[model samples]
Structure formats: structure tokens, C-alpha cells
Target: MSQPPLLLTVGEIARRLDTKVHRIEYVIRSRRIEATGWAGHARVFSEANFDHIASELIRMDADRHPSTRSNG
Candidate 1:
């Protein structure tokens, strides 16, 4: 039998990504990223969602700090 895929909560993703939960929440609130599903009132994310959130965070950072972005 196949095992179920792992799901991560906001806190888990923030810990793994070395960021704050509020930052993740901001992205979600802005609709840049989305949760895979909900576990009660908490949002649950799949690996794909994690990757999307990570990339969106990076993009957000770059947008906020244009000088940090490479011209190349």
C-alpha cells in the first residue's frame, strides 16, 4: 500500500524556511500563495504549496528591495 503524502502547517513551513509565520500569513492574505487544504481552522500545505510559497516569498522580498535584485 502507498503511504499518504506529508502535509505541513504554517509554523512548520516557517521553521523549515527560516521565516516568520506572519510573513507566510501575509502572502496568503495577499493571495500570492494558497493552502492545499484545511485542518480545522488551520491551513495545511503540500510539498508543491511549500515550493510555491517559498518562491513567492523570494519574489516579495525582491519587490520590496529592488536594490537587492540583480540587473543581470
Candidate 2:
């Protein structure tokens, strides 16, 4: 069986998403997205969950900016 991907830290994810660490915590608390462990101490994200969160954010941004929509 294939091994699971490693978890991601809050700071790492925030840096990648170009957002504040607090925003990450807010998402976790609100359950807008699921994550593993706590923040600063043991916070981490699965590859699938991270991708899911990223996709959701992208979709939200697209919805906010109709001009960015593609013809296809």
C-alpha cells in the first residue's frame, strides 16, 4: 500500500496561500475545512484536505471576480 502524504504546518500553508496564520485557524475552527491536530503545537493537514481547501478558496475567488472567468 502507498504511504500517506506528510502533514503541513499552519505557517507553511499560510505562506503558500499568502494569508495570515489566524485565517487558517479560523477555517479550522469554523470547520470550513477539516484538518488534523492543533495549531503551533501539532497542526497539520493531509494532502487531500489541503487540495480541497485550496480548490474551495480558488472557487470562492472566481465567484467574487466574474471578470476572471474563462470562455471555456
Candidate number with greatest TM-score: 1
Off by over 4 Å in 1: none
RMSD of each: 1.8, 3.0
Question: Can you write out model 2's per-residue Cα lDDT over 1-72, one digit (the tens) per residue?
Answer: 998667888778778889878867766566566567665776688877677766766776788998999989
The reply for model 2, stretches above 4 Å from the true place, is: 1-4, 26-31, 38-40
Measured with C-alpha atoms, the lDDT of residue 72 in candidate 1 is: 100
Q: Give one digit per residue, the lDDT tens place, for model 1 in 16-38.
A: 99999999888777865767889
lDDT of each: 0.88, 0.74
TM-scores for the candidates: 0.81, 0.67
Clash totals for all candidate models: 0, 0
What pairs collide in candidate 2?
none
